[model samples]
Target: MGEAIGILGGGQLGLMLAESLDRLGRDTVIVEPDPDAPCSTRRGNVLAARFDDANALQIFFSRVEVATFDSENLPSMPLAPFAGRLVPSLEVLRVSQDRALEKTFLAKHGFRPVKHAVVPRGADVRAAALAFGLPAIAKSTLGGYDGKGQHRLTTPADVAAMPADAPGGWVLEEVLSLETELSCVVARDGANAFTFPVFENLHQHHILDLTVLPARVDPALQQEARAVALGVARALDVKGLLTVEFFVGTGRDGVRALYVNELAPRVHNSGHVTRQACTVSQFDALARILSGVPLNEPRLHTGGWCMGQLLGDVWLAQGRDGGPLDLSAWRDFPDVVDVYVYGKRHARPNRKMGHFVVRADDATTAAERARAFRARLMGR
Candidate 1:
């Protein structure tokens, strides 16, 4: 039998990656605990087991020549036995998984992350945050995303109000005064790297709501963001993809600068619009990399695009339990180019269910139309 690409997590990202691999006539093996994971149920070749299960890893490594991950949160120590076959290496995952380690590496390497202080695990979070000063954001150093494991400390008592337990430690970050959020995704093989266009991100309730391509910032800043993402991929020695989220901020001192917000070691949500907006989609880029296909720089396929997230809330708003959405409203928005609904089993508030992309003459206009499309779908 021929070799296959192994994925460590079977979340939506993994499912999408597997689909892209399939288009290339590549085989994929996924290891995930969820039997109903989108890839597990829909794509097959899944070993329904825990990430660190020794028996699962043994079976998993036997069939695949190389491995990658859908998430950076899994334990790297357990995979040390099979580390030789990992795409980006365990060290990359190790640093990117922990906020403290990620911050330290960036600073030590002369990259500026937002100013922050680390509060060791089991320490008094309130006191540490107080010392850092009020009007801060406290995030656990491990396994946080989409607003999870975050706390806002405004007054002296704000940290104490919720008092989130941080067994994995915490990082208290300085809040920015004002500006936009942006992200860049870099695709790399062993010897070469390339970046997608920088994306302007907007969030609601701390969850990524919309992404605008050809980011609404000075062209120079967009160029800088792309360069930063490629540099970080090189620093990590990435063999797949690395996404760097950024902050174009004016700090309290009233200084405007670009700061590294965080890193994701796989295809990102912001890059979803690339499916229709760029010559090569992020998923296809990674698939080609995994298959050792020669890389070519991707160019704009559309003038501009916007991708809007569809949370489970949209389903609940539609009064459905679990199934395809009522996309009857599509006739109203001609610019809405593509819609994707993941085969997730449950619908709960704030959970990402799927996404849609809109192409327009310009990205800002696409963003506006995407928002309106979602509102219409939600009956508002």
Candidate 2:
């Protein structure tokens, strides 16, 4: 077994993965640009360097047996030379980095995706708007996340108002008035792969607000989504976790169509619940795959649910200019609520400083308690 693993991105997801690695008796070396990143604060021996630097990554990759990323934005070309195991390989990155390419790839496989056009450099945005109609979205082909680098145009005027830099090498798509946004998280080791239950995602202001367990879709749709996800994993020859986001709604012709919205070539925000809800987690799955181990059949041991992404503005600390935002405040709550605080240096607006998850037997109770706990954690 590989003794050490190197992770490329040091967000809260990486923080949780670090803890999982420690529990598995494995060491983690996180390479991030921020010296005071929260993951580094809790985990020792983190290398504060840019993931895009070739020489730095070569040196960093030399020490570890395997490499994985918390997110997909890392430059895949530079790391292609690294000898260590890299999950969701460069081919995956090639297909996923460009929305236009991913959609074309999906369509080639007879999988339906939203109709989109590549806005390659100074193309008529108005033409795309005319083709796709109003209520379309212009999205950057790369480096976009958490609803960033995206423009929702409701009219021709909105299309005209697009930033000059925005239309360059981006994608324009006809926005579907969808019923809901859902994500399917799956892990593969080339031969054998395992998939988790679908997550019915709720977004508030373009940011994920909550994820409901065992998606509310019918069995047929759920199966379609899973099969599509597995096809994507296998087609890309992914060796680790892959999160595929989909838009679920009926088309103008009155037929149910699942449009793949985006793809994350690593562990995703929506899958954070697997830590407490499933016997094997995305991180653990990745670890086994990178180490040449077989995939484990996922078993949901308990009927548990998790809520995360607690905003920093709402979380406070004691004697640090702000009052106490201690977990001890929720001592009365059930132990099912797992608190994970990223040891970040600062708590700025919209910064994901930490997350707390509470599991329960049923959906209603879990939602109620999670909201209640969020209220208390923020001193609301």
Candidate 3:
């Protein structure tokens, strides 16, 4: 076998990344503590150790030629030994890991983000939030995703009701008049770079529910979105994949414009539609990039593609609990091209279990079909 690649986390993203590596005949060793993580089924390939296990990392480093992380939440200090071999570099992880740092970085680079103020831990959350002004949100600076670690303050009372101490401090953002959300996945290998079709994403309760492309926006806005994504990748000088999420809304200036929302310096949930929409999926692109394979720009197929996330709630609704979901219903929707289950050990509300892709003649049709399909899946 050829040299192996190491992954820091073994969740669904890691599983998909491993599958991509497998196609390149590259072995993957993952250091993840969760015995029931999505990649746990890989058995011997998994270290089944904590991220900070120095001894396990020594063993892990010895077996791999290169390393990449699936999640930025992994402690960077533990992986210091393999810093030289870390793909995408550790700086990307550091800057993207904390919301405050990320926002400051963006603003420094002249990218407009929602205006806000940072409230340090142990400080007054309510007073700080009110200072940023009422009708805002306070998000913990670290380890928050899928709508977690967020508190909305629409009134002074709401701000006063906020927790006294935020675990990682907080970034309070003035609420904008939201129009829609969009994302662009940018992949790079040194001098070469590629951008996938800009994806228009729809979130429910702060969790992404569906993503469709080409985004149903003005052609100019789509172009601008892609340009901004590239600019972000260029600014960071990152070597792997970066998915930049954007908000199109009425900004504090009272003009509808695009603002950087957040950054995911790895394969993102929003990019899963690439598996069917483009010649090169996001996972495949990252796999090749990390493996030192040359890349040709991916060509988009002539159709609309929509990826609908299947959260754990769907499992409970189907009466499976933690068991395998009933895929018997898939045969009913021809447009539903693919279904991916993460092989998770349990099912609970809002946890992303898998996603499915639908293809149609246009973006609207594809999104409509995807929503209808999931609705039927939930009903039956």
Candidate 1, position 170, lDDT: 93
lDDT of each residue in 190-252, candidate 3, tens digit only:
878889989999999999999998899998998899899999999999899999999999966
In model 1, which residue pairs have backbone atoms overlapping below 3 Å? none
Question: Which candidate would rank higher by TM-score, 1 or 2?
Answer: 1
Model 3, 260: alpha-carbon shift in Å?
0.3
In terms of lDDT, the best-performing candidate is: 3
Once fitted onto the true fold, the runs of candidate 2 whose alpha carbons sit more than 4 angstroms away are 1-3, 42-44, 252-254, 316-324
- On the 0 to 100 scale, the lDDT of residue 213 in model 3 is 87
Measured on C-alpha atoms, candidate 3 has an lDDT of 0.88
Residue-level lDDT tens digits of model 1 in 1-380: 23999889888889888889999988999998986567767545898888889998998999898888998989888899988888768888999999999999999888889989988888888888888887999998998988888988888778778565774799999899748999999999877788888889999999999999878899999998888888888877888899999999977667899999999888888888888899888889988998898777777775778999999999999998667899999999999999999878788899888999999999889999999999999999
Write candidate 2's Cα lDDT for 289-324 as tens digits: 666666787766566475666656655433232223
Query: Worst lDDT window (10 residues) for model 1?
Result: 35-44
lDDT of each: 0.88, 0.73, 0.88
Between which residue pairs do clashes occur in model 2? none
